[model samples]
Target chain A: MWSGWADIMDPHSLTKLNQCRRERRAAILLTDLGDGSDRVIVEGDAVDGALGDAVANAFRSGKSGTREVDGRAFFLNVHLPPPRLVMIGAVHISQALAPMAAIAGFDLQIIDPRTAFASPERFPNVRLDAEWPEDVLAREPLDAYCALAALTHDPKIDDPALTAALKADCFYIGALGSRKTHARRVERLTAAEISSASIGRIRAPIGLAIGAASPAEIAVAVLAEIIEALRSRGVGAERGKAA
Target chain B: MSQTMQSAPPKDPLTIAEEWLKDGKEVAIATVIETWGSAPRPIGSHLVINKDGLFEGSVSGGCVEGAVVTEAADVIADGKPRLLEFGVADETAWEVGLSCGGRIKVYVERLG
Candidate 1:
């Protein structure tokens, strides 16, 4: 019921930004406060000067703010893909984790080959994949935005996903096992030709040293650990913030 | 995965704005450009409105949406953008101030 305005934001830019969001790609909407002009900058886009530095920082921190660049004010509205929690097993710990992770804004998914464990009745309202990690992850690969947790305690089911997560450099990679169990896992993974440095990234004895006994308690510990990884991402040495 | 990510909610203000524009409706987007102290909403939050007063999303908890909606009408009528401030310092605090005592600067402009 109206003619378009001459100075309105280009509809093309809005659509592009939304497309980036749907693609789980990072984007920044840069708007000049003085002129009300705007454009969308996808991650890895080459932007120059102080503004470019600001844009890069926003992409890393996922924080939105107004920056003063070259005497002009620009608002950088950043949209990073939501973090994904991909559980390698639909065990009891995952049952507790599924709901808790959702409350914390994670896109939680459970992948298990055993239909008996990944049944809809067990994981209602969660993304349950009653398929092998190899097949599911092949279709939807892991990314730095994803956190992979191997919980089945079975080498056949957990080892392959752990290998994939490490290869993909997932922000958080965890495997559930005792120290002895993890040692054997390390040996097997080492024999598989995965570099020790890459294998070292896996959080074994998974979760924090919270002395968690119950599955729900362990879920809390694991979620906290994932948050720690997510927050301290990109800064290699600052991971000592939490025990 | 990029190929399989679900769509954004139908009620998301920006999505609604794009849909409304595609439907040939006049739309205005209000964005919180800055916030101070205990602002209810963070910077970059959006509130979108159509010329018919239909709106979605919120720039504030619920305190200043009415004023933003009113200003959006003017933005839709004219192509000029509007920068609005609401806080304890403004003289119109009694009328449209944020009850949380925080300050926010919102930029509203028409969407083509």
Candidate 2:
């Protein structure tokens, strides 16, 4: 007997089953019937037993269904939110910046090769990747909303991530270094064939020149710069619309 | 019932009245309704005093707390609200230490 019980009832599967069984709850999907007109129709309880199969059948047959409960039909639009901040260091600044980013509605993830530095105790509420930046960041999509910061001064850590970030057109790419260090960084990137225009996109001194001497003060400066960049982008977008 | 007489956290003289009535305790709330010259606390400052002489949230520094608390306890026991004024100009005000020469009017209400 091939019953639904054959699969262990995980929360997701259980939710789907429960949604199908409840008459008041409806599963909505936009569909086009073969009549050249796209209209929504409610599914009945009989189709509940094969809800997953029905959805698959609709897609396979190029048709969709809109389930109705209490005369209201909702169309599901699966829009994924953007990728978040990908910090390439597990330093003290990252520790302070992670919580502030979380509060500002960022999905914060830290990537560092050092296992001791990326431990859970240091970053209690952040996602930690104990792999090198290039390996870890390669798994994630870097969209325009994505923020990538290279907090490590080491070329081994910063170089690979900066290369990836430049290729991806990440919205914000910042590297923490002194003026002299950034000069050396530019020379290194030039050797790697990154153009001056791409290098200009980086906030090399990493923060507003606030004379920050402590990790906490530096974190504030970095966040302030990020906020200013985001705001300037927004203003430019609005001006483009006015034109 | 007045709007301030609603049973909520004491916003003013009237709200404190309702809170005291609900708790079945004699209490006084002193509101800094008006102030002149350099005052330590601004207008709308509140100090709540119960019949037991316990209080919360300050209205002034050491200069006025003792006298305000005493006056508040008296108002709570009397079940009458009175506007009490004190400042550096008043002869007895020196005892309360408001020597900064600022005048303040406190509305003391028996919140019972």
Candidate 3:
């Protein structure tokens, strides 16, 4: 609980901050106007990365906030990475989801092992992980800002990704399927040892029941549901870096 | 190099500075670090400007963007960062910050 101004605007801190955003790391930049001491911290890292106790709460809440340390006021600007949408299918629906989600401000990644389906000609201008869904999730490891959508009705592709999403606890976990298909999915997942609670996290028959029939309409419904979940959180309440 | 591997466009305002820096251009970024009342843009919104007066994004919708861009050029040349404040000082200048009846504080910083 202290503060001071000690040349906080040095180029080093700003450079490191840019790296944090580039890497999509949740970070907080603490600026102490008292003596001008600036400190930066990336999530999962100690505030030691920050200059001092200026950022008392390394786990500070909210996108950003201001605090008074001693008599000096400190402005904490939290920069979370853009929300990531990881679609575990390169199906017709995904083509629509990709551009739509991008327009809504999500960083996109499509994961599918089916080479012909995952072809860039289909995904054009989208991030594609031709590797299996589990492998991509294992390598990338979804964060809170990530939303996982398993559109392939195939268990091999969708289940592993759904398992990964549940484990990662991403804010939104959606899977495309009819009720009958979803019931079978639940049994398969239960046999795979995924908890009912975790499986419950998925929004089955994913997307708002807009009675969507076409792939593009279904895409709109799904993207809308994702946005609803992302926005419905105390999320983006203020100056969150959600977008 | 497949299109799937093509990089997505930068979505964060902070990326502008990093991109312009790597492109070997003198750049300045004006960010809406704070706002009061009906400010147009939320905090962290940015307007990236180069020495050429070209800028991207918005800090105040249309109200104070021109002023911020003009000052960004000075920041680029002077290598100094400055805070800009804009809003209606009175009933007459309500056009200054627009009818939003709010004020915004933008921080303009020069980046290499």
Candidate 4:
């Protein structure tokens, strides 16, 4: 089967696939359609294609699956950027969180307006955005690939970051704080018009309750909780249930 | 002049294939189209091979790389795409130490 010849994927589809990769847009590649055919479909445009629904669904799960279109089977390969963890504070916890997240196959970035907290000296080799959460989030925006965490205990910083994350519909929204502090934060967010359902989405006291004592332990807890939310879709969708 | 250092990001499979083609390498790309059971790698994982046996990336973790490379050599020469399959039934799995290895379906195609 390896010695026959033909370029089944048209140049037009090939160009679209390349463009999607360059833009970091999710795309589904459908190949091996019996006639040695291949087609790369980008999101939003897939539904118009022959295997549109399969492409759209595979895009969400980020995995490859086979579908039988008529008697012939086709494989849909989903491709998207690596998952990203956007840290809202450059705290001691974040210092530990960044490298661990990278090791877990997540692209990590620290966002803080305070220059002292976000300096390159402190966060060497990490993506540091030295702008207020609201401003930076507004400019760059967040997508499904992102997991946003607010590590700063300060309301002035963490609250706005959570608010932005909710709007972006981040898969995971974690806030580092005590239960008492989260209650106060909730009150403020309620006052700011963030819905109860949205507030519930925040993984308060962030991280799994592993009886963490120090910043490093807390970082471990946080990363663990984030993974739970990521791997367990039900856990991540807890906010939707609040409605 | 002191130059600043920046960390380069990982390139996607298409970009790697394009680069290989640009470098005047005769390339055939093997992509994991479908998998059953414990697929160590996700779908869309790619292995690009040149006529000279040089390869980049992987389709399966390691179970069928040698077979894919040998097939890819024919693909590069014949210009015909082949859909290849490897499973636990294949003796290569025992050699690769994959425990009752899963079935992996890869599509090997020539990319110009």
Candidate 5:
């Protein structure tokens, strides 16, 4: 039953796993408890049987645990990239979000065309890009691991980044605006050729409806929402209870 | 390029292990494959050991590391993997202070 266990740890496998991690790719390091041999299975790599199901589950759950398959135990160590929070405006809410997001383990970045608001004095120790979101995002493309918050009320600054985030399949895309404002913005995006379905993914009024009236409290709501979106990814609609 | 914050500010054990391998040092990687009760570290926790007994990471709350490191040297020399189990019930574990009423299985193997 334990014939599948291979003792040698493949050097190339470790190298490949590290490369996958550095590239922000999801992977699983599967170690056979029978013979102590292991290999790294990337997210899209195909596998069959109970182990395949286990791998898929691990990827979705982002969990590490031992599994028994055909009387052989295997340890699946899941590695998902750290989540990123990209804010379109380095404004008051972002100023509050910058530190809170960092403490919450989100790599936060703020981009705004206005240098006055995006200055070091405002967002110290934060990754502040004093440039248009389109220009900054063109170089640093968004991906599934990223959560983009379009805080700039200006459509000129927010719309292009929202389109990019939607196109890149960002895990969470939120825009700061009221329901009425979002309706108008939706019309503009539709005029700009963005599909309604894609536009619908944006969370307008961008927060967990916690009655957050202040900038800092609103920042809390947005960060909580982003966390919810991240933790619930691929897990269906199992959302956390709102505070 | 956009100044997006990429936070890997501190090097983790696996990254250090890769670096040690690249630097041509003989290394062994010990992982916590299983844990029960109040094991301080969770499963998949890594403790990497180099030839000179220098190590990074942790498998327990400062317990059983010395033994794991000693065992790691043998793994590095022989290129054979080893599975080590420790529990509070064990005499050595009681002596070494894994007395947190927990158990853990560590798989140690040479990393090329």
Candidate 6:
């Protein structure tokens, strides 16, 4: 009987049988082998086999998988958003503000032409650039997640940055100055052809009027204002409350 | 381009909580939910506690951690959330060395 069984199962037939066994373990089956002229026939329980095939295809294509288990198809998708920030100064306020912003989920960068002010030691954890504002900002594209703040209080340092920030449509643009300083700066910017609406976008006297006197206190106020600005833009309340 | 992609390590409390969570441990998070005048930690400062009663953050200086950590351990073990409060009235405010006569309320939650 064994000899007869062996004779019935030839090498080609044995190979096909083994393949079928493997497919069955995987909840699928190959019903027919394809020749050059005909396609392969694969038949299995549609619920598991077809669904699994769809999921595999989706995974291979880097897309959300859709599979009907009973009568419902479940879709799975994953999205990871990008990070952004724009600091238009390398002053003490920037030193304090950058790390605080990072704690609240911002990617901070400091831009200034004063090499002495912008250094690894001064901004130990932030990115620093010792370049002219317009030259540096022009190369980086701004988006909704981006925030721009000028803390230098010097027109040479702040004006070019304000121009770039206004042009790029950054979500937040704040400049650190007193009321008198802001009035003078606005005049200069208006003369430079910045629109009133764009000028209005700046939050000069850039804080919540918390009577902040120290560098750390001023840092807190600036971060608070930035959070409020971000909240108004609809990012959400939790982010605003983080710092 | 480089100016847009730099950031620092998170605040100590947040960083500690994240590290603990990533390590697959249940953590208890405590926050200074409310405060009056002259509290050391202020509102929103945090303290995180692990299952073993080990803590990685501070809600206040030496004055309040002992009580807060005890409460935190209870929270971690029982998985029940609770709010703890510490305060001083105007008369005894100087006892705890809280110079600014006021009160403070801390909210403690168990986070797995």
Provide the TM-score of chain B versus the true chain B for each model in turn: 0.88, 0.75, 0.79, 0.82, 0.91, 0.75
lDDT of 4 by residue, A1-243 (tens): 233224544434555677786676777777755766677767656254445556655765677778886566887877776678999899999999998998998987788988889888898888898778888887778876689999888889988889988987777999988899999999999999999998998998788989999989988998998877666543333356547
Better of 1 and 3 by DockQ: 1
Error of 1 at A113 (Å): 2.7
Residue pairs with clashing backbones, model 1: none
lDDT of 5 at A20: 91
DockQ by candidate, in order: 0.40, 0.01, 0.17, 0.28, 0.52, 0.06
Global lDDT scores for all candidate models? 0.88, 0.64, 0.75, 0.77, 0.88, 0.62
Q: After superposition, how far is residue A12 of candidate 3 from its true place, in Å?
A: 6.9
Candidate closer to the true structure by TM-score (higher is better), 2 or 3: 3
Docking quality category of candidate 6 according to DockQ thresholds:
incorrect
Q: Which has the greatest TM-score?
A: 5
- In terms of docking quality, model 5 is medium
Off by over 4 Å in 5: A1-5, A236-243, B1-8, B99-102
Evaluate residue A198 in candidate 4 and report its C-alpha lDDT on the 0 to 100 scale. 89
Give candidate 4's error at residue B100 in angstroms: 15
Clashes of 5: 0
By summed lDDT, the worst window of 10 consecutive residues in model 1 chain A runs over A1-10
The fnat of each candidate, in order, is: 0.59, 0.00, 0.13, 0.35, 0.69, 0.15
| RMSD to true structure for each model, in Å | 5.4, 22.4, 7.0, 5.9, 4.3, 20.6
Per TM-score, what order, best first?
5, 1, 4, 3, 6, 2
TM-score of each: 0.82, 0.45, 0.65, 0.71, 0.87, 0.46
Could you tell me how far off, in angstroms, the CA of residue B79 lies in candidate 1 after the best superposition?
A: 2.5
Q: Which 10-residue window of candidate 2 chain A scores lowest in summed lDDT? A: A31-40
Greater DockQ among 3 and 4 belongs to: 4
